[model samples]
Structure formats: C-alpha cells, structure tokens
Target chain A: MQISTEELPGGVTRVRLDGRMDIAGAQSVDLKMNIVAGSAHRLLIDLEKVEFLGSMGLRSIVIPARAVHSRGGKVVLFAPTPMVESVLKTSGIDALLPVHHSLDAAIAALE
Target chain B: MLGLLAASMPEALSAWPDPRLTLTSQLEDLALVLPWLQALADRYALTASTRFAIQLCLEEALSNIVRHGYRGRANQSITVECAPSPAGELVFTIEDHAPPFDPLAPSAADAAPTPQSIDELQPGGQGIRLMRRFSSRIAWEPTPSGNRLTLAFPLAR
Candidate 1:
C-alpha cells in the first residue's frame, strides 16, 4: 500500500491511500496513518485507488480516525470502491468515519 | 515418446480441479492470498462482489487463526480449500492446527453494547462481524487436531 498526502485549503490534509487494505497493506500504513492523524486536525482519507478492505484494514482506519477524533479533529473517507464501501458499511465504520463520494463533499465534510 | 507421455499424465488433469492454498501462521503469508483468489475468480467467473466477499471472509478467518488461535506463532500450518457445493454455493474451508476455538460463538465482544462514538469504538473486533455479515453461510467445527471454519457464498446473486 502507498499513502501520499496533499495539503488542501482550510487546513485539511488529503491523505490518499492506494492498493489493497488487507492485513499486509494495513500493517504497511499503520504508523504513517497515526503520524498523519496526530498532526492533522482535519483529515480526508482518499480511498479511490484502494481495491480491497478487510477487518485489519478497518482497524487501520478506525484507530487513526479515533486519534483525530480524540484530538477534536475530523476525519472523512473519500470515494471508496463499491466493494471497499460495502466493507465499511458492513463493519459500521462508515458511521464513525463518514464516507463521501465526491471530492467537494469530502473536503466539505472536513470543513 | 509423445504418445507414452500423454498416456502417463493423470486423467484428473483433463478436468477442472478444486483449488487449495496453504500457508504458515505468519501474517506475511497473507500476501499470497489475493493473487490465488484472483486466479480462482477468473477460473470460476465469480462476480466482483462475490470475489470481494470471499477475500474479506478468508482474510478475517485466517488472520484470526494466526493472531488469536495460534497466538502469532510462526510455522504453524493453515490450509484453505475452495470447492463448489451442489447447493449452488462456493464453500471455502479454512483449517488450522491451533487449539480449538469457535469464532462464531457469541462472546463478550458480541454482547457488548455498540459504541456510540469513535471514543467508544474498538478497532480489533470487527473481523468476526464482517465474516458474519458477508458470508452466505458460516460454520465452525472442532477438528480432532484443531479447528475448521467453513464459509459459503452463493455462486449466483
């Protein structure tokens, strides 16, 4: 998995995640995600390129989202693929970390 | 020589065979799983959603075996076999040599009240829930040596 970040207007950081978010993928990004969450007040996790999501992947997202949330920050997931979205919904992580289908809507959520 | 070689080949090679994958208890072995599933999906013409469900459930099951059942021990044997059922489902059997544990059984985690906020959320327990929600049917049995989990998905749907 690859994680890249962009600084958007209004102090939001767009962290784009690419590749499968399976066990290995989750492990590969866990530390970086925590670091990003620790610093950014508003986080937008772009999942457009993520092809798969499993339970461990859910952990990778939830833990960071929680870190941001505890710090009074906001996190929004952006444009997960259909299958990945289903995993999010099924696991109910979508409730904790809101999912937005559009770039505008996603950035808006962080704001 | 060519005719003799052809006759010597196993007759089963002419037919489509069930697929099987084996791995050690190490989490890194998971890297091998998706590509194997992709091959199965191509061979069986599985729908994208079906393939995704299988991958999700298998990862959940296997990871649980490695982490909790085997306690992250390395070199333990784990095997996964995929076969088509007569009932119009594709069944995946995951067998492990760890001590018996029934993941499907209702546990404290299942009974715990749902978290109302991110503060209350627990990151690690979602695996069993995902397996339950995504699989068409799930069963767990204690094998003589360890445990076996069977997850089935409808071939059509």
Candidate 2:
C-alpha cells in the first residue's frame, strides 16, 4: 500500500491511498495515518485506487478518523470503488466516516 | 511466515480443484494467502462482491487462528483450501491444529460491535462480523485433531 499526502487550500489535507488495504497494507499505513491525522485540521482520504479493503483496513481509517475527531477535526472519504465502498457500508464505517463521490462535495463536507 | 504446502483436498471436498495452502500459526502468513485467494478468484471469475467476501472471510478466519486459537503457541499449523463447488459456490475449508475452538460460537467476545458512538467503536473486533456478514453459509466442526471451518459463498448472489 502507498499513501501520498497533499495539502489543499483552507487547511484540508488529502491523503490518496493506492493498492489493497488488507492486513499488510493496513499495517504499512497505520502509524503514518495517525501522524497525518495529528497534523491536519480536516482530512480527506481518496480511495479511488484502493482495490480491496478488509476489516483491518477499516480500522486503519477509523483509528485516524477518531484521532482527528477527538481534536475537533473532521475526516471524509471519496472515490472508493464499488467493492471498497460495499465493505465500508457492511461494516458501518460509512456512518462513522462519511463517503462522497465528488471531490468538490467531499471538500465542502470536510470544510 | 506462511508456507504454501501442496496438499490434496479431503474426501468430502475433493470435487474442488487445487488451490490449497498450509500456513503456520503466524499473522504475517496472511499476506501470502491473499494472492492465493486472488488467483482462485480470477480462475473462477468471481464477481467483485464475491471476491471481496472471500478475501475478508479468509483474513478474518486466519487472523482468528493466529491471534486467539493459537495464542502464545509456536510452530502450530493451519491448512486452507479454496475452490468452487460443482454447484458454482465458492468454497473455503480451513483446518487448524490449535486447541478445539469454534470461532463461530456465539460466546466469542471478539465479535464486532455495532458502534453507537465513536467511543464504542473498536478497530480489531470486526473480523468475525465481516466473516459472518459476507459469506452465504458457514459451518464449524471440532474434531479430535482440531477444528474445521467450511464457508460457502453463492456465485449468483
């Protein structure tokens, strides 16, 4: 798994994730995601490139989102493929970490 | 780590072909099993939903074995077999030599909680829930040797 971070306008941080987010993949990004959540005010995760998402991957996202929410920040997800999105919904992560299809809408929601 | 040992399918599951792996009681071995599952998924042309279900179920089952079934043990072994039944159902049989434990039992506290609040949500407890939610059918048996778990996913569903 690979994660690249970009700072957008208005202090929103976008983290683009690529590859499968299974056990190994989640482990690779766990520490780094927490670190990014600490530094950013609002976080947007791009799951367009994530091919497979397991429960462990869900935890990777939830942990960081919890960290950000604890500090009054927000986090959202956008562009997850249908399979990845279904996994999110089945596990109830969709309610916790909202998902948006449009980039602009995601940015607006986070803002 | 996970070592892929070539093992023949058992008598009851002989109808399915040769996508089999034997893993050690190690968490990292799960990494090796994903590709094996992907190969089977592709060979059978499983749908996106089926593929995801297979991946999640395998991960959850194996992780449970590593974390709970073989807790604090070493050099234990788990065997996994994957194939499509003649009725076009994705089949997975996981056999473990750890203590006789039924992962599907209702008393397993590791089952994922439906999060009402962020404070109630946890990261690690979702595996068993995912396994139960995604697969069409699951059966567990505890034998004198150890335990056997059979999971089936409908191809059309």
- Report RMSD for candidate 2: 6.5
Q: Is the docking of candidate 1 incorrect, acceptable, medium or high quality?
A: medium
Error of 1 at A42 (Å): 0.8
A22 Cα displacement, candidate 1 (Å): 0.6
Candidate 1: tens digits of C-alpha lDDT, residues B10-121: 5544445448899999888988888888878877889989998999999989988989999988999999999999999999999998998888777823842456788887
Please report how far candidate 1 places residue B109 from its true position, in Å. Answer: 6.2
- Candidate maximizing DockQ: 1
Q: Write the per-residue lDDT of candidate 2 for residues B49-125, one digit (tens) a residue.
A: 88888888888888888888899476799999876688778789999988898777787735666787665668877
In model 2, what lDDT does residue B56 have?
83
Stretches of candidate 1 off by over 4 Å are B1-18, B108-113
Pairs clashing in candidate 1? none
lDDT (CA) for every model shown? 0.88, 0.84
What are the per-model DockQ values? 0.74, 0.69
Residues A1-111, candidate 1, lDDT per residue (tens digit)?
999999999999999999989988999999999999999999999999999898788889989999898889999999999889988887777888899998999988887
Model 2 chain B worst lDDT run, 10 consecutive residues: B1-10
